[model samples]
Target chain A: MKELLEKIFENIYSNGLSEERYCDIKEFISEKLISEYNDYVMNREIVAKNKVNTLDIVLPNAKVGDYYSQLLKIEDEEIIEYWIEGLKKTGLEVVSEIVLDFQKEDNTMVQGSANLEVFDNDNIECQKQVIGTKNKGLVIKGNPIMSGDFDLTLKYKYKGWFDGCNILERKLRFAINPDPRSLWKDIPTDKNIKFYKDDFVSEYVTVLANDKGLQKDIVAASKRGRSHAHEGKARDDDFKLYHNDENGWYIIAVADGAGSAKYSRKGSEIACETSVEYCKQALQMPTELEETILELSKAEEGYSNRSISTLIYNIIGGAAHKAHRAILDVVKANEDQVRDYATTLLLAICKKFDFGWFVASFWVGDGAMCIYDKERQYIKLLGTPDGGEYAGQTRFLTMPEIFTPESIMSRLKYSIEEDFSALILMTDGVSDPFFETDANLNKVEKWNELWENINKEVDLTDDNSESKNQLLNWLDFWSAGNHDDRTIAILY
Target chain B: MRRLPVYLLIDTSGSMRGEPIESVKVGIESMISTLRQDPYALETVNISIITYDRDVKIIFPLTPLDELQLPDIVTPDSGPTHTGAALEKLCSQVEKEVKLSTPEQKGDWMPLLFIMTDGHPSDIMIYNQVIKKVKQHNFASIIACAAGMKAKVEPLKQLTNEVYSLDTMDSSSFKKFFKWVSDLIEVGNKSIGATDELLLPTPPEEMNRII
Candidate 1:
C-alpha cells in the first residue's frame, strides 16, 4: 500500500502529466482481462444477411439475418474446458478463447494477474458478443440489396412495448404542410403521385415533435444529432406526426426484416403504417381475434395482396394469427403474388385516457417484446416463440416457411396508467434481439439466461430523451441492444 | 473507522444536454478532488464511476485506496436510459469486482450506490428484473435521485431506500448534491457509524411520497 501511495505521490509531483491522462492510464491498466470477458456476454450479433461476401463467418447453424452471440467469462482453464465440453454435449461447435495479463508499475512487486476472453462468436451469431464502448450504439452488418453495408449505430431513447422498442426522434423536419419534389428516384410521374400532403404532413409534425423533445420539455433531441457537422441518416422509417390541441405527438415505428424477403423495407413500412391505421380505426370500438386478424389481414391483403404474408401482431390486445409455416411447405393466398413473402410482426396499441394509460399487445413468431411498467421494475414480455424450432442448437426464423401454429389466441392486455406516452410496432428485425445466444447458453436457455440479472445495466443519463436516442442507435449487436435493423418509435 | 465504497452511477443519457450535463461532468471531477483532499475519506472511501448514456457503460470499476484514478469522460450528446439494463449489468459487475477483493485486499463492508437519473428507462419493464437482481445481491445500499428529468419517482421508490427529487434542473443543485454526498462520505469514513450523514436538500413538503 505504501509503495502504491509513493507511486501516486511521484505522479502528482511529476510535471508532465494531466489528471485526465493519469486517469486513463489507470483505467487502461487496471480493468484487467477477466471482467472484460464477462462484459462480452451481453453483446455481438449478425444484423444483415444480404449475401454480400461468402467469407461472412457463418457459424455452423447460423443464418444470414437476425443472429446474436454472447461471451461468458471463465477462470480456471479446466472449468473453461468443461464449459466448452457442456456446449459440445449439445452437439455444436462452440468457439471461445481466453486472454491473460499482469499489471505492473515501475518494475516493482506485481499487484495481480487476470485471465479473460478476447472475443466469442456462437449460435449462428444469434446474440451479440458482449462488449463495452465509450459511445453508445450496437454494431451490426447487413446486405439490403444494392447496398453491401455494416451498420454501427447507438440505441438512444426508447419506449419498450409489447410490439416494438421505439427509437426516439433525433432531427428537424420543417415538417409542415408543403409540396414534394424528387424524393424517390424512379416514381413514374403519372401514377397517383401526391407529394404535397405527404410533405406537409411530414414537415409540420416533425418540427412540432422536435420542440416537444426540447430540453425544457423534459426530453430533447440529441445534441450530437443537431451538431452542425452532423449529417446522420434522416430515417423516414416508422415515423408519423399527430396533433392534439395545437400540440404535436410524433409516433415512431421499429420493424425487423424477414430472413426470407427480397425487399424488407417495403414490408417494414407496410406493417407499421397498416398497424397504426388499424389501431386508429379500432379506437372508436375495440374488437377480437376474428375481427382484428382475419379482417385486418384481409384488409391489408385486399390492398393488392402485397401485405398478405406479413404477420400483424399488435400489443394493445387483439393481436393474433399462426406463427409461420414451420418448414412444412404450405403456401397461402399471400404467396400467389410474392413467393413465400412472410415477416414476423409485433404491434402495440396505446391510448392514454384520464385513467393513467392503457396499452396492450399480441404477437407470434421467433421475435421478442419488452414493456417497462410504471414502477420501472416490471417489464412485460411479448412476442414469444410460436413453434418452428426451439430446442438444442436448432434455432428458427430463417424462412417464413418454418412458421407453424394452428390454434391462436390473444396474448394481449391493457394497463391503467395515466403516464402513458407512446406505442411501438416492429418486425422480426427489431424483435430478434430478445432471443439471443451466448457462449455458455443458447436459445433453449432463454429463460435461464435473462433470469433477473440480465436486464440490469447502469445508464448515466438523467433525461430519458437522450437515453431514447442512444437506445435507437444501440439496439444493434455491437452497440448495446440486440443486433438487428433496429427501429424505435416513442409516442409522447 | 468505517469504510464506505461510494459508487457513482451517472446518467450519461443524451437527454442531459448542454451546461447542466457539463456541470455534472465537472461535479464528478470535483467529488474526486474533494474526496482526495479529506485524509480520512481518502483512506477509507473507495470510489468508482459507472456512466450510462446510451448503453450501460462502466467508466471505471470499483477501486480502493490502492489503485484509484479520476476518469476522463467525454460527454456524449445522447444515450438510452437502460437504467434497468445498467442495474442488471452492475449486479454482475459488482459481483465480479467484489470477488476480486478479499478481506486482506480491501474493506469488508458493503458498497453504496448513488443512482442519479434525470429520467426513466427508455426501454421499459426490463428494469423490474434489474431491480430484483440488485435487491437480491444486496451489494449496495442505493440512494436514487431524479436530477433534471420529470422523472418517474414512483419507479425510483421501487429500487432504493433514499430517493430524492431535485427542483428545476440546474448546476447549483448538482454541486450542492455532490457536496452533501461528499460530506456523507467524509463522515462515514471518519467514524465507524453504519449510517452515513448527508446534508441533502429537501423536496417540496407537499409532494406525495411513495416510500
Candidate 2:
C-alpha cells in the first residue's frame, strides 16, 4: 500500500498537481483507506461476531397513477432501525416505527426494536402508520406520478456493524410503467397555413318528395386527416351529395385523392362534382330505367336481367367514365400528367321504387359503399376494394385501364332491398379503420359496431337538427396509424 | 392494427471491432428515439435487427416501437462477413412475421429493408442465390448502404437499386444517415396509397445515394 501511494504521489507531482491529478490522488487514497479499515475490522474476533456484509432489500416495481405499497425485506437481524435518506423527489414514505420479531441463533424468537425514518415528508399522501407490531416490515407506500426506471441510492444507518462503518449505501432499482393511453398526442392542425385548400365542407341536404313517397335525410362531411394536418397540408378528400327532388333520386359521390400527388385535391373535387352532375342529368329523364328496374324487381330472386344491367350501367357506370374523362380533361387543360390527378371514386344513385329501394353504385378503388340493415342484420357491399399486393396500392380514376369496358362493368353493383337502415359511402380513411378488410365490409357485425360507434356520438333515432355537426364531430374518432383524408356520405 | 415492419441488417465482422461497431449502436439508438417521437411511426412501426459475422444472429426480433429494447451488439476479433446467411435468415423471418392481406384479415403494410455493410460478402455464391428469394417477398423498399472507405459498392449494388455509401464510419455520419431513415419511415407511413412509386426523402450531406 505504501509503495502504491508513493508511485501515485510521484505521478501527481510530475503532472504538476492539476485538478485531474488531484481528483485521481483523492480517489486512490480514499479507496486504500477504506479497504485497510475493512481488513482490520474483519480480522478482530469481537468484530467478527457482529460483521454484516450484505443487506438484501427487495423492492417491487411500480406503475404510474397506481397506489404502490410493498414490504421491504432485509435479512440482517441486528439492524434495529434503518434511517433511509435521499428519497426527496420520489413519491414514497416509510412508516415511523414498528416492532419486529426475529429468530436468534439459538432458534428462539425475540422482539427487536425496529423503525424506518424518512427525512423528507414533502410529498407524503399516505396517513396510516406501520401496522402489526410483532411481524412488522418496512413499507414504502405512495402513488407514483411519473414513469421511468429509478435508481435510488439509499443511505441506511443500522446497528451491529464495525466501528465507523454503520452507514451502508445500497442501490435500489425499480421501474414505473407509463399509462398506455398517455402516449398518443393530438396536435391540432394549423388552419391558416400554406398549401391550405378550402376544407370547410359540411352539407345537410334533406330530400322530401312527399308525393313520390321519398323522404330521405342526407348528411355529408369531409375532414383533413391528422397526418396531413400534422404537415400543414390540404385535405385531399371531396364529396358531393345531390338529391334530385323531381325524380326522387339521391346522387352521392365520394372521392379520395392520392396523398403523394400534388394536384390530387383538385382531382377529387372534379371527380365528385362531375360524377354527381352527370348522374343528375342522366337520371332526369329515367322513364326507361324506372321500367327496367320495375321489371327486374318483379323477376325471380336468382334472375339476371340484361336490360336492367344495361340501364344501370348507362347511368352509374357512365357517371364514373364521365368523371374519369373530366379529370383527364382538367389534367390536359393544366398541362399535367394523369398521375398528378390520381384519385379514387365511389358513386351511388339510389331511388325508392314501388317494388323496393333500388341502389346502384360504381366503385373504382379502396373505399367502401354498403347498404346496411340494422333490423335484419344484413349488409350488402357494393363492390370489392381494389387492394394491391401491397397495402397502399389501389386503382385510381385517372388510370386509363380503369376506363376499360370490362373494368367498368365489373365495378357496377345494383341491389333491390325492401328497406335499409342506411346507405353509407366512405373513403379509405373511414373504411380502413371501421372496416379494416374488404370482407369486414360485408360482415353484419362490423356494420353494427360502426353504427353503434356512430350512434354514440350522433343521435340516429330522429332527424335531429344537429346531426350534421354531430356527424362532423364523430369524424374525429381516434384510430392509431390510420390518418388520411376522410369523406363520408350517409343517406338514412 | 396494421404494423409497418422494418428489418435492419448490420455487418459485424472482424473489421468492425472498435469504434465502428460502437458508432453503429449509437446510430440505432438515435434512430429509435427519433421514431418514438413520431405518432404515426410509434403507432405502426415494428423493428427487427440481424447481425452477420462468421455467423448470423438475430439480435432483436420484430418488436413494436413502444416496447423495443435495443440489445448490446458485439463483434468478433477476426471473422468473415456471411451476408448470404444473414439474407437467408431474413427471408425466413419475413415469411414468419410479415402478414399478407387476405379476404378475412387485414395484414401488415409492405415491409421495408435496410442493409449496411463495410466489406464484400465472403459467401458470394450463397448471396447471389438468396437475392432472388429476397425479391420474391416484395418489400416496399430495399436500401443497401456500404459504410466506410473499405466498403465495396459492387456487392451491395447487386442486392438493391437504392444503394448508398458513407465516406466514414464516424458517429456524425451514422447519425445523419439514421435521421434520414426516420424521415423516410415517416413519409412512407403517410403516403401508402400512392399510385406511382413511393418517393424517397433526400439524404443528408454526409451520405451519398449511389444511382
Candidate 3:
C-alpha cells in the first residue's frame, strides 16, 4: 500500500504538476470537511428524509474510466474512487459488495465500503474533530442494493494485476458493543466481596500462596491499555470489560461468534456482557460459575437457530476447571451451529505477582494455550490451537475435544524478566500455523518478532507526515497482502 | 427464587386444527406477559414447549420468564401426531438437562409438564416407555388434559392418572384453562418449599365467583 501510495504520489507529481498543487491533503481535508458538513445535514434530514437536498447521482460511463477525472459536487463536496488495482477504470462492470465482519464482541471491519459517505454529527451536516472516541471514517460506502432506483457506482481502471494470497495467519478482531456499564466496570455496584486465600492447583502442581500475594499479580491483566484493538474489539466484543468495583479486581471475558447459526454473533455479545453482569451479581447475587454454566446449558438445550456463548469470569482469583466433571460445557451441535453457535469461553482474575498472575483467558471451541510465565513454554491450558481433532476427529459442542482438568499441564516458575511487558493471544487461525513443530522456528520466532515490533515506538521527533508515515510503514510491513485479518491486543 | 420449570406439551396432531392452536399461542403469550407483571412469577416460572406431529420438536427450551418468548404456535402443516415419540423426546431432553443441574438452578425436582391433546398416542409401546422414563427422571409432572369430543383418555392415563376433560373444547375454554394454570403457578411459587404438590384451580361448579 505504501508503494502504491508512493507511486500514485510520484505519478501525480511528475505528469500532473499543473493540477497537482491543488491535490494536496490540505485541499483534500478542506474538501472533506465540506462534505462532512453535508453528510451531517443529509443524515439529519434522512431521519425525516424529504427535507434534504438530493444529489444528481450518476454512474460513471463504462468507457470513460480514469480517462475522465473530475469531482462531482453534491450538497458541496467531492467523492472519489481510485482504481488502485484493476483494468480500465471505466467499462469494467465493477461489482461492489459491502461486508461488515461483526464479531462476538461487536468489533466491526466494514471492508470495501459502499454507500460511501462522510460520517456526520447531530445538526447532521457538520463534521467533528477526529480525536477521543469521536465517530470518524477514512472511507466507507455500501448500502444493500435495496431498490432498483439507486445511486450510480463509479469504476476505476488500475495499473497492475492483483494476486490474492492464501492466508499466512488468521487474525480475528473482536470489538465490544455493549453499554459501557455492561462490560467495562463503569457501572457502579454496591456489593462487597471478601477475598480469601486457598490452595491453588494447576495440572501438575499446586501453589500455596498467601492471600495478599495472589491478588497483586492477578490485577495486572485488568489494567486497560492503548491499542487499536482495544477500541475496535471493544466496540465489537463485550469481552474487553474486565474490571471491578473494589478489591483487587480483574475480569476475563470471552465471546464465541457462532460460525454456523444465523445471529449467533448476538449470542457471543450476550455471553460477554452478561458475564460481567452475572459476575457483578455474584456479589449480592453470589451464583457460582459452575451453577451458572449448568443453568446456561439447561437454558440453551433445545432452542434452534440460536447460538450458545459462554463467558466465565473469575472475580476473586483465577481458576481452570480442576474437577473431573468439566465445570463448563458450552455446545453447538452441528455444522449449522458449529459455525454460529461458536462459543468462546474466558477465564480471568487478578492474582499476586509472586503467587503467580491471575491468568484469565478464553477457549474458543478447542483452541489451547500454554502460558509460559515461569518455565515450561508449552503451557497447555485449554484446547488445541489448530481447532482440529485427531485423525479426522471433530466435536461440535455436542462433543468437544477440550482439555479436561485432568489432562491439563500446569504452569511452574517464571523464566522471563519479572517485568512482564506484553500478553499475547491467538484465535486458532494463527496458532495452528505458528506452532507447527520444533525447529520450525515459525510460531515462537514470529510471535517474539511480532511482540517486539508492536512494543517498539518510533521517535516522535519527525513532522506529522513523517511520524504518521512511520506507523503507516509498520502497518504496511505487518500487513502487506497477508490475506489475514490479524489483530493482537498489547497490554502496555 | 424458587424456580418452577413449566413444560408445555401441545398436540400439533391432525386433531388440533385452527382455533385451538391459535388460542394456545395467545394463551401462552398472555400468560407470559401476565407472569412478567408479577415479580414472583417473573423470577420463578420458566417455560419450555414441545410440539408433536409426524415427529417431535422441542419448540422452546426451559427458559426463565424474560427469555421465554410466547412462541407463535402454528399447527402442523400436514403430519400425524406421534404422541409416543414426542413424549420420548421430551424425556430425553429432560434427562440431559436434569443430570446437569446444580444448586443455582431454581428447582431440584422435575418441571411441571402439561400435555394437552385430543387424541391418543400413535404408538402405545413407545408411549409406555416414555412414561416410565419420565417417571424415573422425575423431571416433569404429567397433567394430561383431554380436549375435543373425541378425546383420548386411556393412553393419557398411562402417563398420569391426573387426567381431565375440558368442559368444552373452544378458544375461551383454552384461555380459562391457561389462566387457571397461571394462577396455580402464582400460588405454587408463593408457597414454594411448603408443598411439593401443585395447586390446582377449582371447576366452575366449585367456585361461584371468579377472583
Candidate 4:
C-alpha cells in the first residue's frame, strides 16, 4: 500500500500539470492512506487484545504458613514470550518495555502478607514488575500469614502500533487454606478456673518397675487435647499404673471422662485411682485368688474353669464396681448428680505365672484394652467398646446399669498366653484415632502400626529414661476432628 | 480425616429480593471468614448451601471449608418459600454424604444443620411429613433462625428446639447473627464427641434465642 501511494505521488510530481494541483493531489491521497493504515492497525490491536483476554492464567492455591511458588504462564511458555509470539502472528510487535502491576482492591494482600517476586532473583517486589529477558513472569512466593479468598488485578502494559501504550487488566482469584495444625492453640489449663481439679491428677504419670519376670516397663501419659487446651479446659482423662513387686502383678487403669459432664475430670481421677488401688490390694500374694489363677493357668486351653471365671470376676469385675462406688461416693459427698461425674473405666491386671501370663481386663465404656504380640502377629481385644447407637455415646461407670453382675461379667475379658508383647489400655481419645473401631482393635496389623508409632516416639528398649516426655509428645499427634483428652498405658 | 459437615438452609423467596438477600450474602461471607480463622473448624468443617424459594436448589454441595467458593445467592422477584423441599433435599444429602462409622473407615462427625427463613413454610404438609426424617439423621445440632418480622417462630419450632430470632435483616444485624453462628460452629467443632445436645454459645445482641 505504501509503494502504491509513493508511485502515485511520483506520477503527480513528474506530470507537473500545476505545482499547486500536484501538491493538492499528493496531500489528499496521503491523508486517506494514513487514515486507512491507522484503521487496519487498530483492528489488529483489538483482535490481539481479545486473544490476550482469553489467555488461561491460573494460579495455584496456597496454604497458610507454607511457602508457595508458581510460575506465571500463558499457554506453556513465560507470559512475555507467549504474548510476544501471539502478537507477532498478528503483525504487531511489543516495541515498548512491558510492565506488570497488581492493582489492589482491598486489604486482602495486607492480611495475607504475600509478595510477588522475580523467579530468578527471589527478591520480593511490591506487587509490581518490569518485564524483561531476566524477568519473564512473576513468582508469587510467601508464607501466607492468613487464610482467605484473595482477589488480585494484574495490569500489563506494552507499546502497540501507535506511540501510546496499550493496557490490559486481568482479575485473578485464589484462596489460602488454613493450616490445620497452626489453628490449634495449646493454652495450659488454669488451675484456678471454675470446676478446676488437681492439675497433677490428669497431667501425666510414668512407671518403670523391673521386679516382675518379664521386666515390666510401663508408661502412661495423659495430655489435654487440642480442643481442651484451646479453651483452657482441664484434661478429662486420667490413668493409674501400679506394680506389686511382692505379688508380681502389673495393674493399669485408664478412664475417659464424659466431655458433657461438669466434674468429669474428678470422676476420671477417682475411677482410675480406685480401680487400680482395689486391684493392687486384691491381687496380693498368698491369697486364695492367686492360687486359683495359678491353677487356671496350668489348666488345659479349652477347659471352661468356672472357679477361675468367678475369681477373675471377683478381681477385675470387683475393681470396676469399686470404681463405680467410688464415683458414687464422690457424688454423694459433693451433693452432685451421678451424671455430673460420668466417666469410662478400663482396668487391666497381668501377672506372670510359671505356665504363662494371665491378663484380665474390665472395660465399662468406650475405649480399648488389648494383649498385642507383634512377633506372633496376635491381637486380643479385651472387651468390645460400649459404643451407643450414635458416635460419641458410651456407657459410663457412674451409670448404675453398668454395675449389674451380668453387665460386669459381660464386660470382663481375660486371656492366658505363653508370652506376649504388650498389654495396652487407652481412652477413646487414643483408641478413636489409632484403632478407630472395635474390630480394628483385633487386627494385628493395626496393633503393629500402633506399636511401631509408639516405638518411633517412645523407645521401648532397655532404658526408658526419656519415654515419659516422648510418649506425651506422641499424644499430641494431629488427627482431624479427633481432639479429645488422650490417655494411654502400655505394659510391655 | 473426619469431616464436620455443616448444612445451611436459606430462604430466597421474593421477600428477600433486595437488601435482605444482599445482607444474607454478606453475612455468609463474613461467617466463612470467621470460621476460616478457627483451627478446628478450618480442619474439619465442610459447608453446603441449600436455597429454597419457588423452587429448591442445592447451590453448593458439601465442600471443605478451605476449598469453598462463595456462590452468588440471588432471590426471585416474588416466589413461595418451599422449606419442605429444602428439608427433603437435606435428608437426601445427609444420607448420601454423611458417613457412618464402619470397621474400615472412621465416619464423619454427626452433621450440623442451620435453617434461616423470613416467612413460614409454603408447603406445610410436606414440612410436617419430612420433619421426622430430618430428626432421624441425628444431627449434632439443628438451629433455626427466623429472620425479619414476617418470619414465624412456631413453624421453626416444629423442626428444632434451638430456634433464634433476628429483629431486622439489615447488614449489621445479619452480620452479628452470622458471627454468632460461627461461634456456634466453633463450639460444635470443639465438642464433637459429646453425646449430649450441643450447648449453644450466647448469641449477639441483634439476635435472640427463642428457645
Give TM-score values for chain A, per-prediction. 0.35, 0.70, 0.33, 0.70
lDDT (Cα, tens digit) per residue for candidate 2, span A353-433: 877799999998888889998999988999898887567778898888987889889999998999999999999899999
How many times do residue backbones clash in model 3? 65
Best model per TM-score = 4
Q: A251, model 2: CA deviation in Å?
A: 0.4
List model 4 lDDT by residue over A1-492, tens digit each. Answer: 667755776776675456687667778877998999888767765765666577776666567767766556443221232222221111212222222325432324444344553233335365224233323444455567766666665555433433363555556666677787877787777868656754322222333445442365677788877877777789888898887756678888899998878788989989989988888888776377667777777777788888878988888888888888988888898898888788998898887877788888888888888888888898888888887544676789988888788988899878888888888888988888887776777788988898999898887764464677788888888787788888888877
lDDT of 1 by residue, A236-315 (tens): 12332232322221222233333223333234345445544545544434344223333333343224321211222232
State residue A95's C-alpha deviation in candidate 4, in Å.
Answer: 21
Instruction: Please report how far candidate 4 places residue A433 from its true position, in Å.
Output: 2.8
Q: lDDT per residue, candidate 3, B4-69, as tens digits?
A: 667788888765778778777767666665655554455446788899878777887877664454
Residue A71 lDDT in candidate 4: 58
For model 3, residues A87-163, the per-residue Cα lDDT tens digits are 22222221222223233222334644443333233443432211111112112222221111112332221122133
Query: Which candidate number would show the highest lDDT if scored against the true structure?
Result: 2
DockQ for the candidates, in order: 0.01, 0.45, 0.02, 0.43
* Model 4: lDDT of residue B122: 94
* Candidate 4 residue A405 C-alpha distance from true site, Å: 2.9
Order of candidate numbers by lDDT, starting with the best: 2, 4, 1, 3
Provide chain B's TM-score, model 4: 0.98
Worst 10 residues of 2 chain B by lDDT: B189-198
CAPRI docking class of candidate 3: incorrect
Worst 10 residues of 1 chain A by lDDT: A173-182
Model 2: clashing residue pairs? none
TM-scores of the candidates in the order shown: 0.29, 0.79, 0.32, 0.80
Q: Give the runs in model 4 whose Cα sits over 4 Å from its true position.
A: A1-61, A67-146, A154-173, A194-214, A388-390, A462-466, B192-195
